[model samples]
Target chain A: MAIAQAPPRERARPARAPRTPYVLIAPAVIAMLAFLVYPMASVVYYSLQHYNVSKPWDNAFAGLDNFRTLLFDDPLFWQSLAFSAKWVVTEVALQLVFGLALALIVNETFIGRAVSRALVFSPWAVSGVLTTGIWVLLYNPTTGVSRYLADLGLMNYGAAPLANPDTVFWAAVLAELWRGVPFFAILLLADLQTVSRDLYEAASVDGASRLRRFLHITLPHLKDAIILSTLLRAVWEFNNVDLLYTLTGGGPAHQTTTLPLYVATTAAQSHNFGYGSALTTAAFLILTFFSIAYLRLSKFGAR
Target chain B: MMTTQTTGRTLDRPALPEPVRLPRRRHRRRSAQRVARWQIYVPLGLYLLFTLVPFYWMLVFAVRPRGSDSLLPWPITLENFDTVWNGLGFGIFFQNSLMVGVASLIATTVIALSGGYALARYNFRGRQLFMIAMLCTQFIPGAMMLIPLFEIFRTLGLVNTLWSLVIAETVFQLPLSLILISGFIRNIPMELEEAAWVDGCSRLRGFFAVVLPMLRPALVAVGSFAFIHSWNNFLFALMFVSEQEKFTVPVGLAYTLGEFSVDFGALAAGGVVAALPVVLVFAVIQRYLVQGMSAGAVKG
Candidate 1:
């Protein structure tokens, strides 16, 4: 099932000409080069220069000054990086636990399983701003769930979770989890369906308890999927700007700003392309290193 | 020898006749069934609430009149929808989003199809490098690319145009779509195309005749993914297209969210407009989503 496995040599190969494959892939190759590669290269290049759209008179090559400033002078950099790490870990870990549970629960034979799965997974289709919109309506202090609950004598009258620094983190986390868990559930459920029923039956025949069967059979089988999904999700959560941007606007004194959000504000609002590029390069390095280390440490696909 | 024979006979006998052992096993089985039922229903019920509540809240706000405080959306009003669609310029945003989504879908699918075909069938030079490059692109943050991409679009005079968003969306989408489509192409055994070619059809003709039909599910999965992503994309549309008429659903919805005095009803209505197409597409393709992930992403 590994993608790196060589294509079967026995199948009669068509389109064997040297030029044909290149021709077929030209559009994709050209597009990536133009957009992805070129912009990435330019980001690194700009990181070394003093490029600000607002102040052309001061524009010049700054060498490592931007990085130096980011490494030393910028407290917000450290704060946002710390927040990004916290955000990724908490979000990914919670999403995995709940997602795995959701997948397992739905994997069971139940009535209305199809509709249940659809209803549960519907949030995965929602966009970040849309998620923000839905959650905003839910979190509004005057007219939202809090007020409704207050009407029922369940709790207080005003609970502005998004505005309060203490509750904003979890508030955002919950909104994200509403959409995030379904992704892991979908991927893990797909892999779950492929597990051999015979293995479970054998475990049962051996007088193994349900927990033991799950521990011995299902967990081992889902190892690769769990690793892959968590890694992808961690990266996604780290890079994701839309939900946090629209939901909180990195508010309450920059309590919710991720690194990428910081970069966006720097570039789009401040027009500080040079420093923004520096931040972008740092993020790229961190992500690349983290991904490599994760794959290595997890022993991905070792089984 | 007599004791062993008795034990063997007991083992061979149907458990139904062994009243002492039967009840215990049946009891355990029944309890296990009960536990399983509760385990499935209780958590699923709770999670369903968590999932559906926000959507229900949005629906409530969208339908309820502005001044009403009723929990239920009684005396339903289309006023919010009318307000956002007509007044807040979501109609134009909706049209723009549709244009970008459809264009991105077509562009991503067509390009990824060709590129995916190459990867699936042809073991060309740089194939491994190309695959690795595609994988590496996953880590490239779209938010990070805003500055350089803005510059590129400015250089090409594409800034503030829908084409800029279209191109940006297509480029961002190409890598994953290519990988997924290529994985799908590999799953369709190469023999099918060879069989078509054996009937005097050229490679292109063979692909159209034999392979194209079977790729419906894959194309649907990839195209809809592209469409949904493009439609939902905020930063690119935000940075690339600033014109009011060129605003996509996300950008427009973001503006509504960013307003000084928030309009809850209008915002929810706009949210509905933003959500409808993607949610409909998702429901139609929800069945294929897991299958697609297994075939194209996880297994690949």
Candidate 2:
């Protein structure tokens, strides 16, 4: 094959190269199939079976019983799904607003831009557990920020935000927001940099106001980036359980339990793999539908 | 059209008066400078406080004495660090996390490099399907895969082992790393590789001699992403590894948080320890991060 296909000048190279790509991608394909795709398929399979590690005798093919229970009987399922929706919307929206602002601010030629970029974006690298740890200290009643504020007669001492049901949602939101916003800032800033300065200059020269310039040039340019980052962040915020698990423990009576957290609880604490897989399936369907809807509605990359 | 009209208007305006325009232009410039200054600094200042205060609070609690409320760690103490490091077994967790992180980094980069090269260089039969599959995997929540992954790991006898974490992290990291590396490899001209081949180098040797050297930044970006993600991963480490010694940093910190009678100082200390490596790595690679995202993500 090599000799037949080869021209005189390219005789050194072989035409037995069609299989090279498959061979190269074999490891990745195998790994993803083994770890990722296989697990997903198993989740779907187990969602239909009564698989519980604790109760071996009860294990049998459930055949949509888990889904039936999830859709009809489970109040916590609805509650968690609602909370996940609320959580994702609130976090992504706020993060986008603040992150875009921060990106715009730092994108300017400020004196301390380098240091400020590093400092402000540092929280992004911190883990969810670590973010929980830091916020736990800040929200601590006795020796935390409340005590210091109380010392200055600004607010009451022993104000336990995480413990209070009324405040826990906002408390979790604020903490997650701190770490989450930097992601938007970093991504938006990246896109912001690619916006040609000449566009802005041309707009300004045309007597366009700053807001108009942004609306016309910068915003349009960042349309696809904003869409991509928000979708990714929405999925991430919906799936993330680390901060809520540690900070509030989805507590004050499961006030903050996202669907993923609920699934984790079911699987880990109750050992109900079947129910957990059902919840997993539900969450997966919701995300897939939501993402597809979001992309379609946003008209992603249409320009 | 807009640019031409604006230039034409500017040309017409210059005919009115040069002398009158000078002071007006200077006045506009001054006010714009003033507004721009406030616009940059005020919000940035407030945001910096928001960003830095939590970190500062963590540092204060980590360093101050158990009972002190001085706000500042005037008399710095390492007692919390000492207790968490040795007593709470974070020492073992740290070592485990490092092993997992480094191992995942190596695995993700090497595999992604091969897969990315294939994607970039080949017009293979299943190329479109492969790319689409990688994209679809992004929507599969890691948390949802816990039950099945746990079952898989248990079947493989990898439960309570760090290899479970390494494998899980590598799988999750592969799609993005592969995409990013392929995007990068696509940017490098094929002529360079062809030139190397023309000099009697095999395709493999051409890649190593010509392409690999140019792929340093992409490798670093992909490698660091794998390391940071694996190091911070909690669910896999929590579910797969039950033993104390097999714990990662996140699992250790989560346990510290879960204790009924929480020790603030030790928790803060553990948080700091968990934060150190990733933050440092982030600080170094952050410049590339924006660039990498722009190149690999936005375009894709």
Q: Give each prediction's DockQ, rounded to 2 decimals.
A: 0.55, 0.45
Candidate 1's docking class is: medium
Per-residue C-alpha lDDT of model 2 across residues A1-303, encoded as one tens digit per residue: 110111122333357876888999999999999999999999999999999999989999999999999999999999999999999999999999999999988887768888899899989888899998898888888867888899999998889999888999999999999999999998899888888766765566677777788899989999988998999899999998988888887887999999999998999899999889989999999999999999999998788
The candidate that wins on DockQ is 1
TM-score of chain A of 1: 0.98
lDDT of 1 at A159: 95
Worst 10 residues of 2 chain A by lDDT: A1-10
Which 10 consecutive residues of model 1 chain B have the lowest summed lDDT? B26-35
lDDT of 1: 0.89
* lDDT minimum window of 10 residues, candidate 1 chain A: A6-15
C-alpha root-mean-square deviation, candidate 2: 5.8
Off by over 4 Å in 1: A14-16, B1-35
